[model samples]
Target: MAHEGKADEQLFQLLANLLHQVESLTNQEEVELRTKIEALGLEVTKVPSKSLKQLDELEIAKELDKLSEKLDNVDEMISSAMAADPQVQSLLSDTADIWMPVITASADERRNFTPSVGENSETEANCES
Candidate 1:
């Protein structure tokens, strides 16, 4: 009977120690996860019951409709302004002439210009020196 009681006591102590270790590990993991989440610029918070509300779908739809109409009006105004501006018209008409040669020259130079890997490192070292 004495030996059985001693065995039970030892088993309980071992279980208690294991439980404590598991709880410590869990707490450490929770702290690390919270720190990582905070570092990511995200808010980790609980919402209050009073602050939580269902979305008003009808209101959202109405607001989106109003926004769409406003955007269309703005687009029309921009088109009218562009049509009225001679400089804008000239730029639109001459876009290829103004941009094509410069773009083509850059592309041709890039195709021809292959620098050795060591060349870049040497240039960087020289600049640092």
Candidate 2:
């Protein structure tokens, strides 16, 4: 049981490391995409200012809506790029392969682990007999 627990911990760590790598890769890709967009003369404002009190409510709302649309466009561009990038697709496939087995094993373990409710009851009953 102790060994099994250790193995599970190791698997969890591996999964966490893989996920972190994927996240880092995604952030890098997004930065690259933003750079490309900026290169094409579109201003990529990543951090929108929250100080909209100076503007009227309608103006603030309009600004927010505009920012949302810009973000959506950026996302669409990134999605299209990812779809065309074979390396990104391969990395995603490899990650899925590594992730699936661990997840399936965890689910199977959870399903199989049933606690015995009256495990000691039988011994006590035999002693009484």
Against the true structure, whose lDDT is highest?
2
Candidate 1 least-lDDT 10 residues: 39-48
Error of 1 at 106 (Å): 32
Question: What residue pairs are clashing in model 2?
Answer: none
**Candidate 1 local Cα displacement, residue 38, angstroms:** 34
What lDDT does the true structure give each of the candidates? 0.43, 0.50
TM-score of each: 0.28, 0.33
Those runs of model 1 whose alpha carbons end farther than 4 Å from true positions after fitting are 1-52, 89-129
For candidate 1, report its TM-score: 0.28
Model 2 lDDT tens row, 22-117 = 457555535564445344332321234698468988997998899789768856874775597765566546545433453456545544543244
Residue 8, candidate 2: Cα error in Å is 36
Instruction: Give per-residue CA lDDT, model 1, range 1-129, as digits (tens).
Output: 343333333333332333344336445333443343243222212223563666598977997898679658645754764586564344334333322332244434434444357844653453233
Clashes of each: 0, 0
